[model samples]
Target: MEDIVFLYRLVPGHVHHSYGLHCALLAGVPDEIIKRAEVVLDAVSKNNCVERLCNENISAQDDEYKNAMEKLLTFDIDSGDLNLFFEEIFSSS
Candidate 1:
């Protein structure tokens, strides 16, 4: 993870232990939830009960939120679509 960096939006690209937290922040997740995620991330990164902790925490989320997240994760855009989308966006800029 130290050798890898995500490029886009954030300046100077920083490495993250949990990119999902970055995505959650970008998606406007509540500050409290983000903080809680940070705690869980810290625990897991330190080799604490990773799987059990994750399952216990995530399983507490409501079904509606889970379904919505599942739908959001199902996006299947290919490179061509991405190029076209970016062209459409930057062309006007």
Candidate 2:
């Protein structure tokens, strides 16, 4: 959460917001279901984030993919239904 909040604060665009969110989810979540979620985020995962080293460029505009992610993020999952739930959004067990 700390890293995510910090990254999110540093970046002021939709693409970076999603990237920060991906870092939070991937870094914090358990291994079992990681691949499941990865399949969903695969569209946004590209270039290995080493743009300078690899000199690899990928477009940041994919509203269709982001819209799909928005559907995933915006859904209310019975509060603690999330295995990788955001702590700030959760109050109790």
Which structure among the candidates has the greatest TM-score? 1
List the candidate 2 regions with Cα displacement exceeding 4 Å. Answer: 1-5, 10-13, 16-28, 44-93
RMSD of each: 13.5, 15.7
Flag regions of model 1 displaced more than 4 Å.
1-16, 50-93
Native-structure RMSD, model 1: 13.5
- 39-88: candidate 1 lDDT, tens digit per residue: 87887667686444456456655554665555446645653465665454
Clashes of each: 0, 0
- lDDT by residue (tens digit), candidate 2, 1-93: 254243334455445325534564657876534655555455455544322212223223344446546656886887645655444333321
TM-score, per-candidate, Cα-based: 0.35, 0.25
Model 1 residue 39 CA deviation (Å) reads 0.5
